[model samples]
Target: MIDLAPWAWILLAIAGTVVGLSKTALPGANTVSVAIFAALLPARTSTGALLLLLVVGDLFALLTWRRHAHWPTLLRLAPAVAAGLVLGAVFLAVAGNAVVRPVIGAILLAMVAITLWRRRRTTAAPEGAAHLGTTLGYGALGGFTTMVANAGGPVMSMYFLAMRTPVKVFLGTAAWFFAIVNIVKVPVLAGLGLITVPVLLMDAVLVPMVVIGALFGRWLIPRIHQALFDRIVLILTVLGALYLLIP
Candidate 1:
């Protein structure tokens, strides 16, 4: 395992628990995990390590809410997401950590603004089917942000929120989206040499923490009110994005 101070391990354990909670209940909250791992480990190494734990959390999410997935929405996003993933891989291949963090932060902040504006309009005018352009735009951005920093959670949360998805459907869709995306990232990250044996070793020690968090999140989901859920997502997204922009 990679050498780390006791405090560092404590922080990672907390971050890992957040990962589980993010997967099971809150969507944008995982941005905190992205920030934590990025702060503690080399950016690229952190992405790979955090990703495996995310996959583990994804399985639990799937078990909990897989039936709620909106297949049409997933299908609609597939093409643009694939294109964005390619672009993100290219960007990650060349961008320095300093460049990656601020760029992602800016994107998340912009998405938050857009989501808020859309929510206002949607309130004034009844919601309808998601627009093609919006889907493609968010799809591409989600793919890029996820690949670059595992920070796609806020971006996609904005998208789903704009669409006014119900809470259970939102959790289910996000669960599947990240599960597939993270798995696809495996080969790309490995080729980039981010997934080392030490990373796996470290994650092995932390997987149980993720499970613990997932269980807690599952217990909390039904109790959380819809407005409270949305507020928490927005608050966490903004906080995580600001942290990234801090440099």
Candidate 2:
């Protein structure tokens, strides 16, 4: 574990708190957390460290929203998600995150574009093939990006949008999904030699921040209207993509 400067730790704490809130209050803001982690540490090590913190946040999210989760949808996505994870593992080994980052950004942008285009034509939820394809496609995108860079939030957010899920369900289901998936990702990342003790220590200090953020989310969610929540997610996701694309 490389000992970070105090300021770096501060930034990381802020990022972690934001991530926790995003998991519960907003869905797509995690892209900012990933960016902050990557900026503060080595691209790969940062990815590993953030995964643990995310799982902590995930637990909080799941506890808050588990009842609202859409298990049928999660079931449909399972096989496709597995396939994507395998492909993502291969991609991570073959090409480091530098190459993976831009691809993830492009995918997110494409999803956003498609969702916006379809929004005018029909507010009705996508079903059947379109739904399955989205699960597979976004699952693949999420798996690949998360494997290499811990940046899957936006990809999954797009999928939730297409599903036309109610705001709480979207956030709840996404929280459960990421909590389980990020936990599963830990041992895999450890096997890949990305996780290290120093980072673990950092994760420890960061846990409280995640808790605080989760609490904040719990308080905030009931007050805000559903439409406002979705809009915030969309705007934050676009900003996250732009942040990734910038030098």
Candidate 3:
């Protein structure tokens, strides 16, 4: 098993819960989980481990929102996202922990800005009719951020928001997008030796927490006010980013 202090384990459990919640209700909230894992573990190891937990969450999301996805938008994004993934893999190969951590922090911060800007602006395009340029830009950036730090939630959330996707469609589209991307990442991370026996062992322990969060998120979704919930997530994400950036 990958050894960790007691406190680290506690934090990881919490992060796993966040992962599930993000998958079910809030798309961008996993930025907090990414920061937590990165802070507690080796940056690369954290990425690999967290990817598994996110995959578990993705499964739940796929079940919950499977019928609601916007396939055309997904098709539009595929090429750019693939290109960005290649670029991201190259960067991960060369970057050290010190380099990766701050880069992730910066990406989180930039994603926050994008999300905030998206919230302020209203798009004229109808659903599933977003401009090609907008689709490609967000798709590429989402792929890169997700590959590097498992931090694509905010980027893609911004894209969906800009497209004025209905809540269910947004969640469904994000669910499908990450499910595909995270699975693709498994082999790449394994080739890099980031997904080891220990990482798998660790994820097995944390999987239950993700389940709990997903259930809770499902229950809370209808009752919660999204705007308020998003504000809270954004604040926590900023704090998490600042932590990684500082050290």
lDDT of 1 by residue, 1-247 (tens): 9999999999899999988987887665676677678767876677789889999999999999899999888899999999999998998789877887677677667656766776676555326677889889989988988888787876687778778889789878988998999899989988988899999999999999999999999898778785766777678668867877886
Better of 1 and 3 by TM-score: 3
All models: lDDT? 0.82, 0.73, 0.89
lDDT tens string, model 2, 1-247? Answer: 4688989888888888887887678655576677667656765677788889888888888888888888887777777777777776676667666765555455546545654665554567575445556678878776766666676766676677777778778777887788777877888888877788888888988999999988888888768676766676567556655665665
Model 1 segments beyond 4 Å from truth? Answer: 104-126, 224-247
The candidate scoring highest on TM-score is 3
lDDT string for model 3 (1-247, tens) is 9999999999999999999999888777788898899888888888999999999999999999999999988998999999888888888899998999888888888988988877667564356567889888888998899999998887888778778889889878888999999999999988988899999999999999999999999998889898888888889889888988986
Candidate 1 clash pair list: none
Candidate 1, TM-score vs. the true structure? 0.86
Angstrom error of the Cα, residue 226, model 2: value is 8.3
Compare the candidates by lDDT and give the number of the best one.
3
TM-score each candidate: 0.86, 0.82, 0.95
- Model 1, residue 114: C-alpha shift (Å): 5.4
